[model samples]
Target: MTTLEDVLALVAIDSVSTNESALAKYVYEHLIVNSDLEVERIGDNVIARSVGLHSFRVLVAGHLDTVPGDVTASVIEGDVLHGLGACDMKGSLAGMIDLALDKTPRPVEVTWVFYAREEISRSQSGLLEIAELRPDLLVADVAVLAEPTGGRVEAGCQGTLRIKITLGGARAHTARPFTGRNAIHRLGDLLSFVALYQPREVQLEGVTYVEQLQAVSVEGGVAPNVVPDVASCVLNHRVAPDRTLDQAVQWLRDFLGELLDEQDVVEVKDWAPSASPELMNPHLTRLVEISGETPQAKVGWTDVATFREFGIPATNFGAGDPLRAHRSDEYVTTDEVNRFASVLGEWLRSTPNTSGTSI
Candidate 1:
């Protein structure tokens, strides 16, 4: 008999972004054969809902894929597990699987979603596809996204917009630099602005979301000996959730208006909206109480924003140090996974008649 630990150890399987077929199938098949839950598969995403007597449906979700890496999951000191996606969030997925196998009566209707390509972008994310394919499963009073939070309740997220800016100038041999205007120099000006620019911090719903502008990458000259004819840089802006995507883009353009003109191209390559704390909502409040933790703003863009767009209040809470996410040394403790499972499982098991917070 394969215990939940056996299944969790399957984190050893490689499920890099856009390659969640194996893991998705594993979750889909397990739900179908082992439980009476309503299970459905849409593309590489799996949706399973517990058939229980409850007024509110709690959505527990974790992404199925992680960035490319080949570290095999391994046990360390009988408590810690180290691997490519361990802290980046395979641990959260493991906890979800544990709850999915629970045989106890759930106080709230519970839905488990194993999504694909979350490490990609919101447009390609399986969560978005599931919303379009089956909005029925998306409906819930409140939701929890298992993003790495080191076990605290991280509410909401900052919106993100990646803009590609192109600067043009004449190309000439470095020996006669006076014959050409250096486009790379123009990029330097943009970098200077971003380097000195101060980020904004806004307090919303008892949490503060800090906004930032940063240059993630830069590309320019084909050869070192020649003055660059074109230079392009990708700048990512993380805006407070209070600002919409359109609002963030417009702000970016206006902020760079003096240096970048009509001829210079500035395009939004990607964007994702922010989620609100909705801290006062009963469901989120219950999670906070059960976890015995305070609220913090989720700085990174996450699926919590997807559920927020659907009018369902959402928050992020998971096991392990969030800072360890996506690193080569990614790891988590079995103790942490069990603690997460115990807290959330206890909340699910509490009946409406027992706790006013049941949902």
Candidate 2:
């Protein structure tokens, strides 16, 4: 059976994005063992539900995959459980599984989703797949993503955009650099623009969000001996909810227009638009009150946006620091896990009907 110890044991195995079969199997059996919930299996995605005719249902979700690579035990150190999947969501998964085990006979139905392939591209997200196949299954009064929020409710998420700015110039021998237009030298102006660009801070639904723009990568030069003819830079933008993906892309096009060729280099590499904090809902607010913590807007992108895309309200609340996730010293406090489990368990047990009433 999957106990708290079992959860820690699951974390010990490297289930990084590609190898989630073991972890998925573990969850599949764990859910089956505790309740007579209807179960469905697809790839490494596991869905188990307690049937009910309640006016509303609740969905609990956590990703089963982590980033690639493994962290040795020496790196984990003491109680920190330093490993790849320790914080990003394995701990959350453990908490949710524990929640599932402590089932109730209440009228409110509960759904547990343990999905795969969250670290890679969104198109490949396991949640997206379920969103298509069983939209109704995901339909709920509220959704909670146990995505390492340090036990506080985190609403919404920032959008992300990656674009390449290409600079063109003439090539010549380095010894006679003046003979060539320095493409790399042209990038200096763009770099300065990036260095001085101040991201905007926008407020929405009582939450403040910060936008960020940065030059994440640069590539150029055929050789040190030759003045490069082509140079390109990668820009990463964390946009606020005020803008759409289209607007964000257009903004970048305008920002890099001076350095980029109008004809040869206008294309989007990858863009994930942001989501707004939907905490205006009374039920969501009550959840915050019950947790006894002020909610914050998540600065990073997460599957909360996916649930939002379905028009379902979602929040991030889990037991560890997101900063610790994916780091060599990744770990979650056992106290946090116990507290998270208790808080979530109590909330699940006490969430009154939010249909026509003010919860």
Candidate 3:
């Protein structure tokens, strides 16, 4: 019952953030009625699992929500599907759905997770709910998130830290500025440091991770005529997978050593741990070999970090150019869709859980 059109069909549904109620229903019904998998509805999330006590379990996951955009879509040249969510992830979801609908018996137990609110942050993510409420569902030997990776095997996403630094000074009228200190003036060193800071490139587990630090945003200035009393800047650090969240924080703080003594206030706004590579694992090694993909270090933060929390070896693999995600021209080739489904379907069917490890 699952065909190429399944991708197109999913692209048409508007699963924007927490508003994915409709799409959630469709996915639940699809798995229950069209596939032999045992399905469950946890809040707005849909999870399906295969029967039989297989030696190992594998999880296939994708988010249902997308950034706001035009949802209209269509098939193109019989090889392409275009519209919002086509590339950012709906295309992969369609492939996952097709895999779920397939009734063929497989060698390993499979679990499918269609989560919500991934377009935003992890706090609003449905995956967090599943993690907190149903940790049992996430137990798998190895997991795959069908994210937009252009059909490559991407591993070990970088960790992220967002810190807000504030400069405080005495507020005063511009006419008598000499009587008060200008907080804005103190921001120059920090801004200059960020602008000229050279990011380090570190190699971990044979994967080279190019780190990044940026002054992503600035805030403050009470009025045009008054000496600003408070000026704040937000810094985002993309740390290498080798560093944990606490380590990254200490690194950032050490970098701002004198500034801390200068009375600048620093607050950590967000911190997400990295998903270090598990290429050494037998299952992961076999997957990369079979897929013929050169393992690359994921530059951005991804849900792979979530699975990493539970010691699960997880990686990203799927169709659609990740660069094209969240764009108005987002699209995926039907040819790639078939290849995605086929590649994973075969991988799951043939790769038994013989690694002698369990989560």
Candidate 4:
């Protein structure tokens, strides 16, 4: 029966994703004090596990890292709790901790992973590092990521690829432009194409996942007085799971025909493909039933994809508006926090026990 006060108290400290040691220590201490869970740490990531009949394993995960932003003001309105990580995940983490503490006569074994480095690039995510060491430790029948879902189950995430498009040209003096081709000028038509291009919205596994391609950055101009020799634009593509990385690359090539040398269009980044929602699991189905909301697709990529790499299905379920997550006025409804916590507590209470028992 830990209160939101307990949750807010933790939030009061600045636990930006880059510096998660303090928060990890706090969570580690709290889990040790309130529950009979075995705790361990890898860098700043914290994991606490409790055994219950060893029938089936359930992993509850939430990143303790808050995106870098305002942390000086932590406020709680009538129903809203405002702070850096309030909605993006801290609320759900608090609820999970509360649920773990009230786990007397627990129904199923639960593992809590407060992984670090989730806000930045995936390569540095602590979850992935842990997966390499003890992959079986995270093996579970079901995993729920307490990422903000506005109380709905955000099944899975889309995959992303970042490509560098190099537009090559020879340099020449501005006064005698005929001597060399202007690489910057060559980029105009392609930029226009990108501006007017419409991304596709395809349906997968009964969910509509949208695809997007955009030029995130462009650089090549040498000087205003001279015709720039080489120009390059980095196109970041966020593709739906309907297409593989190969398909996505081919699609890009087709769209940007001859804009850059085919060989120069290299894939600078390749994340593992995304996983479709494991909505068919009975416990997950029951969770959706009790929450009384239809599930939806997550547009942005998340650590859930990292877990998917380990053959574990994951989903995002939590409270608060995701748009406000990294913004200055970040906030979450206290009521939403209370409701989400209660629903999780009830679901954990109802899990079946050993001897193939049903609660």
| Candidate 4: worst-modelled 10 consecutive residues by lDDT | 350-359
lDDT of 4 by residue, 81-104 (tens): 777788777888888877776656
Query: Whole-model lDDT, candidate 4?
Result: 0.77
Question: Which portions of model 3 miss their true places by more than 4 Å?
Answer: 1-4, 73-78, 257-261, 353-359
Best by TM-score: 3
The sequence of per-residue lDDT tens digits that candidate 1 reaches over residues 1-359 is 22335434656777899889998888887778646599999999999988767777888999889888874644454567777788878787878887887776666889898999999756798998999889888787778898889787899998888899999888899999899989899899988988987888999988899999999999998597999889999999998989988888888888886888566898889888888887877667777788888789998888888888898878898877889998888788876777677777877765433244432
Error of 1 at 16 (Å): 1.8
The true-versus-predicted C-alpha distance at residue 98 of model 3, in Å, is 1.4
Structure candidate 1, residue pairs in collision: none
Which should have the higher TM-score, number 1 or number 2?
2
Model 1: C-alpha RMSD to truth? 3.2
lDDT of 4 at 251: 88
CA lDDT, candidate 4, residue 3: 53
Off by more than 4 A, model 2: 1-4, 71-80, 223-225, 256-264, 356-359
State TM-scores per candidate: 0.89, 0.91, 0.93, 0.92
Count of backbone clashes for each model? 0, 0, 1, 1
Better of 2 and 4 by lDDT: 2
Task: Go through the candidates in order and give each one's C-alpha lDDT.
Answer: 0.82, 0.79, 0.83, 0.77
Worst 10 residues of 3 by lDDT: 350-359
